[model samples]
Target: MYTPRTPRIVAARRLQRRKDRDQSGRFLAEGPQAVREALAAGVVLELFGTGSALDRYPELVAQAPEVSPVTDDALNALAETVHPQGLVAVCEQVDVPIGKALVKQPRLVAVVAEIRDPGNAGTVLRTADAAGADAVIFAGDAVDPYNGKCVRASAGSLFHVDVVRSPLTIIDLLQDSGLQVLATSGAGEDDVDSLLDGGLLDRPTAWLFGSEAHGLPEAMLAAADRRVRVPIYGAAESLNLAAAAAVCLYASARAQR
Candidate 1:
């Protein structure tokens, strides 16, 4: 079993940091599901697991290229969660430039801006995937999608959709792609249902979501082709970012279908 100080183990631990991940263009995918998806994507450079984990997923271990057996202490040290499923995979980062993703002329996209929470970030990715969005862009101070918390929250959906991290305003990209960029806000003048009923959802579109603590920025809202609010039927004060995204994306999905 590999010790905690093993070169491979040390390198994988370093990937837990954003600086190292950025420099190396690699991140750690923890748990069986994320590792399984990473393996299927053929992006896994190395795999690590305990004896028990290997025994459970023998087929996956057989397919993985660089497998390393680790002691329990090493595995625990590698995992970010209190209860890791005893598996982690080192994977190449899988993000493309926003321009490159836009050039494909996607039918639907989700743009998350200035979101700080990794759990929320990952949930949005999962929702976007479920709605069959062609891409998801994390822009403007958003948390890294490759963060351990985010990866776990996304389950395996992070592997299903194109993810882009960009500093330039996504409004410009959406406009260039001929997509209707819809900014979500509580005080929006347009209602989501009305827009959906008016054939707006049939068009190629991009949904803009902001941080939970703060809604969309004024400039972003202004830049959008239209600003729309999801209707609140009950006494709830406001929808969180993930809930709002699910409603908006599913509406677009249903309408397009």
Candidate 2:
């Protein structure tokens, strides 16, 4: 078994940093679920686990293109979670160009902009996949989709959808896609029900979501074809970024189908 100080182990540990991840074009996915998904996606570059972990997940280990047996200490060094799962996989980055992501003529897309939280970003990605969105675009200043927390939060959905880390502005990209852009906001002209009732949601659409604290930028909101709000029937103040995204994406999903 490889020790924590092993050369390969040391190199894998560096992936914990975004700079290393970006430079290497790879990231770590921990636990069996992520390992399984990464394997299915054919993105796994190397799989590392304790002997017990490898034995427990015989199929995954067998399927991996490359495998390394590591000491518990090495596993600990690689994992980001408080309670480290026995397995971690180094997987190539799955993000694609904006044009390729939208090449399928996506009917439903999720545009994530300026969301700094990795967990929320991953949840939104997971929700978008669940809602059958064709693609997800991480626009200006959004959390990196490959961040370990985001990858974990996605619960393997990161491998299930087309992900785009765009260099162009959200407005420019949205305009080029020809999909109606709907910005989710507390202050908005249209509510989910109104859009549904009016058949506006039937069109190919992209839902734009912003940060939990600040919401969408003024410029993005103005650029959107419509600003939409999710109506709260009860006395709750508001939903968090993930919850709101789930609501909006599903609404569009239902309408388009």
Candidate 3:
């Protein structure tokens, strides 16, 4: 069994960092679900699992291209979780070019702009996938989608959707996509339900979600076809990013279908 000191094990540990992952064009997917999805997506290059884990997931092991039996210490070194799940897989980065992601003329899309929290970003990705969004764009200093926390929070949805990391060309690309851009903000003129009632959500649309602390950039909000706010029914001050995104995405999903 491979130990923590093994050369390959040591190398796999570096994938925990974004810099190394970007340089190598690979990231670590931990737990059975993430690994299984990565395998199904044909992105898993190598899988590392403890003896018990391998036995527990024979079907997944059978599908992996390369499997390494590892000690608990080795698995722990590659995993980000406090309680390691005994499995981790090195998978290829799944992001595509912004132009390519928008080429299909998607009716519904989610643009995650400058969201610092990986968990929130991943949850948005999962929500998008659940709502049947065509693609998710990480634009303008957004959290890396390959972040371990983000990967885990995605719950295997990362491999199911077209993801794009576009630092600069998002606005230009969105304009070219022929989809109306809508920015979610607190001080928007239109409420989400109002948009739905007005039949605006039926159009091909891309929703722009910004940082949790600051909301969307002024430029993005200005460029959007409309600024939308999710109405607050309860006494809560505001909805968190993931919750707000779910509300907006599902609204579009309900309208479009």
Best candidate, lDDT-wise?
3
lDDT of 2 by residue, 1-257 (tens): 89999999999999989999999999999999999999999999999999999989999999999999999999999999999879999999999888787778889899898889999999999999999998888988888898999999999999999999974266766667779999999989899999988888988899999998999988889989999999999999999999999989988888988
User: What is candidate 1's lDDT per residue for 1-257, written digit by digit as tens?
Assistant: 89898888998999999989989999999998899898988899989999999999998899899899999989998999988898999999999888788889999999999898999999999999999999999888889889989989998888889999987366876888899999999989998899889888988999999888887788899899889999999999988889999999999999889
Model 3, 1-257: lDDT tens digits are 99999999999899888899989999999999999899999999999999999999999999999999999888988899999889999999999987787788889999999999999999999999999998999988989999999999999999989999887346756877788888999999999999999998988889999988999989888888899999999899899999999999999999999
lDDT for position 68 in model 1: 91
Off by over 4 Å in 1: none
Ordered from best to worst lDDT, the candidate numbers read 3, 2, 1
Runs in model 3 lying further than 4 Å from the true structure? none
Using lDDT as the measure, name the better of candidate 1 and candidate 3.
Answer: 3
**Would you list the C-alpha lDDT of every candidate in the order shown?**
0.91, 0.91, 0.92
| Poorest lDDT segment (10 consecutive residues) of candidate 2 | 166-175
